[model samples]
Target: MAKWGMVIDLDKCTGCTACTTSCGMENNRLPGENWQDVLFYQEGEFPSGTLKWFPRPCMHCENASCVEVCPTRATYKDADGFVLIDWNKCIGCKYCMIACPYGVRFYTDEKAPIQPDVKQVFKGDGQRSWNPPWRAPDSRDDWKHGVGIQPNGVVSKCTFCYHRVSKAPKGTPDLNPANPALREFTPACVVTCAPTARYFGDLSNPNSEVSKMIANQRGVRLRDHTGNKPQVYYLTGGAGGAVPTDRRGKKA
Candidate 1:
């Protein structure tokens, strides 16, 4: 089995929300529930300050605290390095949300972050939170894997576009969007990255691009100190922003 992972080159990212937009379109998320979010902030002070952005996705931690804290066993880490939620088993207690240091989890039962609630505007068929005019193919609606719009009361997060990644040919080393053959199987955020900052591949394979990038570029995981062991890694390389250093602050 391959341990899939992602490498993001911070130097190459342009702070555009293409990744965020594509993620919402692919996943049928509500207006404010962005599964892939790009965090923008200013560094330094006055004229010397620079605006920088960090693309935040679920870490899909190897040792996921969310999985450990779920009272209903809704959260789980797959052998292939995916941290997924089984929506069927989820009870919306938000324990997993509390457990995640990255603040990537979302419980959509509250008022919409945007003005009028879009979920109410476009009501879901039954248990689903809301029904969009269109949606991922029927094949993508697997609650067991948390692939579709979450039902009422369940939490949701990024799943690395599991509907696509799960179908890649066996033993595929990487899901490179640059490769025409693999583009369809790649995550929407990665495929739409205008700057090509995102890279995904089998981390366990020494020859995989993700593995080589980690080894050569000195990739670092976010909040590694928290011991979530995020499968996602970032290459800051001094040109882009450095890894977030404020450990005392909560995610905005």
Candidate 2:
């Protein structure tokens, strides 16, 4: 069995937010939604200051706190290791959102951030800005939008492109021998990154690329103390936008 996971090398990340943009467009998220957002903030003070950034996606934890708290079993883990939500079973209770430590989940009907620059919202397009690929006028009975069915009034989060991954034939080869392309098996954010900072593959196989990276680079998962056993790992070694200390004077 293959357990899908990801590794993000912070040393190669540029904090350009390409992953965020590609994730939104590929997932057809609302104007305010950011499924793969990057955390960028200033740290330290005075001359020692530096800018640090972390790209955040659904941790897809092994324990999956969201699944445990859901009354309807809307949040569950698949055999492949991704924490998924079934929109049909979701009762809009938001239990999963509250339980999630990473704060990555979102409700579908919340007020989308206004984009006044777009002239008018949707104009005359359709019901939602982007109709889900699985949607048919006659059938709307699926439990969740993990496959792009993001129904209104449900909590939703990243699915690691399960729809795409599910389509690939069994025993998919390693994707990291070279830079992965925007293929059906690759997540949009992974392929679109200019810096090649993100990697995705099966974690169960010790020889898999993601596993190798985790072992070789000393990758770490955020808040592992929670013991959710997040599959996503990050390798940190970059200067993190460090600048030289003052050699001359100060004040402008």
Candidate 3:
């Protein structure tokens, strides 16, 4: 079975925030909520100063503390080794939020954002043209189905766009679609990255490019000492002076 993972090459990342914006738009996340975020860190001094741009998405830990602590089993790891939240099962306890060391999870206190004038047209029999329904407006019935703004009183976070990956076009010989074990690849952020800074593939396949990159680059996972064993890895140092300290430096 393929152990799906991500490799972020710091060398290629410009901290452009395209990935962040794309993730938001694709997921229809709340205006103030972000499934993926970029953090800027400052280091060194005066003349020799340096900046670091750290883009953080869910770490999808092998030993996910968030999953372990969720009283409702709302958060759990998927078969492909990605941590996911079952919004239907989530009870807004925010235990996952507290348990995560990376501060990635979020609780939805109110209904997801609504744009009144926006219209959606469904294709097929009894197809209708109408505005996308809201959870509050629909009495929270919408929360039980499809991707949309999460209902009120639920905890939500990045699922690495599991829905999109599940629907992506199947494989070729090099991509090998016939193998059931080869399925369950692709994530939204990886597909959205403009500079291709984020790479995703089976890390367990030694012949895979991600595996080769891991062998070649000095990759590091955030808070590795905590024993989360995150599937995401970051390649250190690049032309951008070691990462940006702020949005201003990020644009620099």
Number of the top-ranking candidate, with TM-score as the measure: 1
Per-candidate TM-scores read 0.95, 0.83, 0.74
Write one digit per residue (lDDT tens) for candidate 1, span 105-134: 999788899978888888987878888887
Cα miss at 175, model 3 (Å)?
Answer: 8.4
CA-lDDT, candidates in order: 0.89, 0.74, 0.66
Clashing pairs in 3: 51-243, 52-243, 52-244, 53-243, 53-244
The predictions' CA RMSDs to the true structure, in order, are 2.1, 6.1, 7.5
The better-scoring model by lDDT among 1 and 3 is 1
Residue 53: error of model 2 in Å?
1.3
User: Which candidate tops lDDT?
Assistant: 1
lDDT of model 3 at residue 192?
63
Off by over 4 Å in 2: 117-120, 123-145, 177-182, 241-252
lDDT for residue 229 in candidate 1, whole number 0-100: 89
Q: Write the per-residue lDDT of candidate 2 for residues 115-168, one digit (tens) a residue.
A: 652214433133343454433342422345465546557788888877666555
Residues 129-241, model 3: lDDT tens digits: 22333322333223332245665567777776666454444321112223354333455567667777887766677876777877888778878878988888888776652
